[model samples]
Target: MDETTTAGPAPATTVGPAPVGPAPAGTAPVGPAPAGTAVAAESGGWLELLADDCSPGDIQRLRAALLAGADDATRRRVESEAQLAETIRARLADRGRDARELRVRDDLVRRLASLRDSAGLLQEVVAQSRFLLGVDVAYIMLPTADGGRLRIDIVDGSLGDTLQGVVLRDGEGLGGEVMRSGRPLWSESYLDDGRLRRVRSVDSIAVSEHLGGILGVPLRFGRSTLGVLLAADRRPRRFSDHEVELLAGLAAHAAVALRNAQLFEENQRAVADLRQSNEALKRTDELRRRAGELREQLTAEVLRGGGIPEVGRAVARAVGLPVQVLGADGARLDAGPGTDDIDVVAVTGSAPERWLSGQEPASRTAIGRDHLAVVPIRMRDGCAGCLVAVSDVRIGDETVRLLEIGAMTAALVVATERSVAEAELRTRGAFVTALLAGDGDDAELRRRAVAADIDIDAIGVVVVLDNAGQDERAVAAAATRIAAELHGWVAQHADRFVVLARQHDVASVRARIAALGDGDLPAAGGIAPAAGGVAAVRTAHEAARQTAAVLLALKLPGAVATAAEVGPYRSLFSHAGRDDIAAFVEAALGPVLAYDRARGRDLATTLEAFLGQSQHHARTCEQLCIHPNTLYQRLERIGELLGTGWREPGRTLQLQLALHLRGLAQTLAPDVGRRGNTP
Candidate 1:
């Protein structure tokens, strides 16, 4: 057991981790004594010729000259030295046994010393072999992430374009098999091997065997082979026993160098981990110190409510941010942290999407110069609004977390402020509405309207905006900006509802929708329209909504949309409750439902398709991909059961309305239920 442990080897550890950062590269072979002293080893015939003078300087110069050859010996640099140098001339003849071992031993020592001295010693070994071994080409392939494949790390210049970084998996190429078996392999002629034919990168079998003699040794640290080291001579260079020994020695040295690099990297990682832990601890202490002060500021802001722009400002300050409050949809509510010296950046449509879709941690960006955090402000579990935090530096985790907490507290503050502002606006909007309705004094209403940011006498249109999704911040922001723009228009007449929509009920306003012409507004897409608003508001909103829906329905590849373009459904404006439509459909579709229950067929999908097809036999058949006979039969059965034929426009409309209502019910009812369930 002891002998095996020392000589036979204990099982190998995993291929050490990849070296961190850059490593020295090239290859040379040497043997190591028990004390780890590297001694030069003899090379086959070449080493004897090179070591003729048997001087260390001579050997060094020879090694350098050989290593100097172009990766492919396409040039005669190494060959030139071999020809002119006495050592090179000596290689033209055979040398004595004592001289060969001495030469081999010296080469081994230098190779081992290089490995021990450099970070990328393995790479160096491959480079040295190309110089010293008179090989036409060479490469060092390493195992990939899975260790199931070999990847070429370095290749000769001639093969650079073709084989550099090429991957050869186990059982693949001549090199791959050697890598898999942890054995030295040689192909005196590569073209003859059936296995080499399998190498994918080698397009031609002739090309694979072009090397006169190809030699490979598995690179192993212990029992596991990292990959294979390959050397190829384009001309028939005899593979001497000493040459094999030298290559094996280099392979061993390369493995050890790789292991050392991996250990150095591991030590570095340990230090980095310790550093991060210490940094995290420091941040925790900072957070703790600021927590108390932040909590007080937040409490005070909450008490003031959202109407006060100062409250948003206060929250930003508490979290050390220069934030602008926004609605859930991403609207700039009231620019907090003052806009005087502000620099605007890119704006995405919705605040929620922006916040949630962060690819990187939010904290880092939140503190960047002119960085803004658009935080949604929630009240009583509902998102009442949003706020932005602008800072001079990139935000850290501590900053983001603190801001999140502060926003929650600020929500109540901002909401309270909004309530107060809305009360005043509502008083004015009410008078204006009454005047428009002919129930109030017009002059007084007009005067009040102007105060509420509305010009009752203006010929301009009113607009009421609401976000369709949870991201009200952007929508609310667009509303505010549009309102400001409408107010700025010189139509010489006032548009009612120029004030924020917060004061008015979204469903009660009614008017014809007039969409803005392309020239009338900036091309911001995805705005929702409010059809249920006061005259101009409803008109403008409906136009916007219709535009949005049409755009959405069109499905243009890259067309953008805005809330103002997406109009409310006609049903939303109707006095009739949607539940009535549902009741009607439930009553009419009983037979179809019954049939579905009996047969387990998806009757609902079929009915939906049938109705949408407008009773066109060809279209319906194509859509359903059924025979005309089958479609007709189903339609007939449906008509008999539902008391409506495909041609009955009125009944068809009713069924269509039913389907739409049911879908709406499924989606909208859940929120209603959840709200009702809440205390």
Candidate 2:
């Protein structure tokens, strides 16, 4: 039969020559059979089968015909031509498919732009994707908050309801694989595919939906996979690369939509929060202004000499709290009205002194139903006191700050009062000094003393402190304390504090001075016997000066010696460096001194104490706090050193005179007789 009359469709004209005309009926075929006649005939039949869209059985029959009697060149030529035809067909098919895809993409873009909300846009997108992809089911599986799995959030197409809320674990099945790999994945027969991890929940859902194949594409934004977009078929199907790319494009649009929706919602909440914060700030500013006015009013009251009482009342009225002012000595200076329930004493006693020392104001919870806020009143000296504000209602920070300002005002008042009192004391002290120094007339001195609230005519002892090594201000402070105790006059005499106290109160004055003790200095004081009138003041002062001199010259610290205590030493020290006194001290203490030097003993000190006690062994031992036997032994040693004539009547008189002179000489001149040699 002719080529046109063949049973199958005809092959392309470019493939080869048509079938030979029956080999010219008898003789040879035409002209060497056209290079490859037999192979061309076989190849032509195969091409015919390709053009007919034949079933596999028809294509198999055509394969047998092409192979029969075909040389290697024919086989190669057939393969090359077949590949060329396939390429041409694929290019033509792509051109047609691209036109269709362009149309679908335009429709998707138009639908997405027209939809006002993310939910509508996403639903429409999945619906269009399912229709375009020709799948049984199409859905979006977006990541949950924790990003460990994906849940179906949008669905469309046949059997879509079954996957409405289906969740896929990470790395499980096709959808999980796409999300984890951030790429597209497809399975022709999902249940039979061993490449993907199988999950019971995913498998059960697929079985129920009659799904045999699936294609999944990761929904990506930048480098992050937002979720997976999936297309599935009921019958087994091999998904095309083109179909995966289309779904991935749709997923990218969906990610942008979701992110936009989230941003719009977040901005809306931020605007609402900002408005609320603005309203609260306005309220706070108003409170601050009101607090400022309260502080101004309290300050005005203080400036008008309202004192601590007025301050307390102002604070109580402004803050609606009970207020109390405590002095440095813990005395309650003022308490506001209705402060009966507030325990001023307990609060002041319990106030933290450390806080006051550090100058840090603090508030604390108090007993009963009250709250206590303490603001310390500080001055140049130290903490003057604290203002304690008590309230049944809780006090806010602004109110506490206002109370601190009030405390500062009270401290100013206290500091001013102290300054005035100190100035007055200085003036009185100057007048008393002039009177004691005998610089002015006696009558004039007495008159000035009376003017300064001092009684010069009263009988009183004159006490003098010498070489106290204290600054004038410290001395003044100590003198002020002592004068307050004695109700007497205290003056700065040279470098000493001189006091003229009442005769009956002299013992109390001495006790007070002794109690004052030696603070940061070695103070020596001397008290004269009580005498009357301004004429006797000079004599008593001279006696006090002499006694103080003796105390200092002897290196005796904190010693308050009187006229009676010094006895003969007063007369001996008065005539310092006299020949008769030196000779007598040499005769009496010479042997004891020599023995002490040779033996490295304190025999001279023992002998002096023994003789000072008038040879009373028990009193001397008691004074020394030593055993009587020890004293007796020392005395025996002294007698041995002195040839046993030291305790006789005439000898004792000489010895007593010498001991008195030696003590006086040492006090007068410290270097005399210091080398174990008599002066």
Candidate 3:
């Protein structure tokens, strides 16, 4: 029998001999070899095979079989199971590592992706953090403005029901201690830890049975600590190194997210502020444009054919008011924006003092109980009149401001119109006066006089005076006083206008006033005979204006002029070319002016009085309230400097003109030191 042939019972022919067996498909065949040689050669393969399943102990058994002449099919079958087992073990190890990595990566990715909704970013960060570490409770607490409190922004699970939106104060509890130090804390047991304190003061701090192994890491951005991230276990659980690292990463991400959100909010606020400012600027521009248009329209209307009364009526209608146009005194009723058909509307009486006196920013009277607005009709010169309106509702501030501005424009138009009308009246009156004086036809003269409101039979007269720089109160008072005095004189004579003073042309007023009543009226008090009629008025006005101008030019360390006076330079008034007048002023006043420059004295006072007194010692002394001796001494000095006798006729006239010019300069001057240096 061939040993190579497979048999039920094999016969041992040698100490180590080959045995026969059927081979499995796709396996190498095994054969007999020398005992030691075969064992040695096959032991390496068997050891490598045993590494798949049974390990080194199985290698011994395979080596023994090889020495006992094991067949090729048996060894090959053994090798297959060992190799198959080894491949399966390697695959299983790789799968486990991949699964662990996938879980960690998926968690990180999900947490990062959840930051889209800013409202819930903190909540998601806390809730998802449970998977990566040993944490029974996780919360994000943001620092509040007040140092004592920390605002719980988000918490995990049912923690919201127990601790949602909680505030913890510093040094009050475990969380408090963490915030106070601005550092991470770790404790095996929160209640048991000696460094941790239990909060008892507030009823809101929820007391759990035992929160162990608590950890609090500060959430910070640069030097600014935003809040803290807290994690705790119910049963004490130590955190691994990797878990701590994960928490730090979470804290970093949280800080960045919060900062980014804040920056975004600030950007939005800046945009809103810019838009608001732009809108305000646009509204202001529109208001300015509207004001310009309104001014243009009102000016055009006044320049057109409308008289003051007509313009007043139109303005009153536009602004919804009852309008009155008064003369400069506010007493002389000039016109009313009222229709005669409207019987219920009463016109302003000749005297307006009763209605408009003692009022500030003008006056207001309620129409029934609902509405009122009173605005002074202010002119560039002064307030000539006022516009008063009443409505059935309360007026707002903006509306009042607008009404005032509109009223001011209307007042300016009225003033301009008045000036034009007055000038026309004056020209017409002068023409009529010349005709009557020239032996014109009696009927024509009387007819023209009546039409022009002139009194040819009473003798023509004009009285002009300084208007006090358009000081409305002073002008009105002076005008009233002057009118009363003239009326007294006229009443004694007849119902003749002894002094008919209009508000225009002060230059000729004194002459006109002087021509009245066959020179029978008493003398004007303290006014020189040379300065009668329109000349007197012109002289007084020129004196005042000049005094104001002088004070302004000299910077004469003083307050405003309360009073000013001018007297005639008789000889200069009689004769002297225009060029001679300028030269005379330069020579006479030049020495005094030089003295003033050097000494800073108000020499203007003495110079003005000396010229007005015609260089007479008694007159100069009386006017200056000094003794004649003192007046003479001053004059002697002046004459010595001027190189002439103080009483010389030609010199007197030159000195007077110089004094008048100096006074004129003062009139144009600004009133300095009016407001004392109080501030």
Best prediction by TM-score: 1
Q: Using TM-score as the measure, what is the rank order of every candidate, best first?
A: 1, 2, 3
Q: Could you give candidate 1's per-residue lDDT for residues 421-537 as a string of tens digits? A: 557545654654454444545466556556665544343333433223434444333444544444421111122123323223222221111132222222223233333224554
Location of the lowest summed lDDT over 10 successive residues in candidate 3: 488-497
What value of lDDT does candidate 1 attain over all alpha carbons?
A: 0.53
Candidate 3 local Cα displacement, residue 584, angstroms: 68
Q: Give the lDDT ranking, best first.
A: 2, 1, 3
TM-scores of all candidate predictions against the true structure: 0.45, 0.43, 0.37
Per-residue alpha-carbon lDDT of candidate 2 for residues 1-679, written as tens digits (9 for 90 to 100)? 6322432232221111122211122222222332233443555844454454432324323333454688999767655654454444334444555666778777777666555565676688778777777777788888877888888888886454677777878887788888888888888988889999988877887888888888888767778787788888888988666667777777777677656665666777799999889977886796677667777886688678677788778877766677777765455677567666667646545645545656444555455566678778888877877777776676677677777767877887777766765676666667856765566887788788877777877747887766645545545555555566567777765566777776555566566678765332246777786677776876776677667767776677558877666655555434353556777777777878888888899888888788788889999999889999999899999889888667788987877767766766766553232222122
Looking at model 3, residue 62 earns an lDDT score of 48
The TM-score obtained by model 3 is 0.37
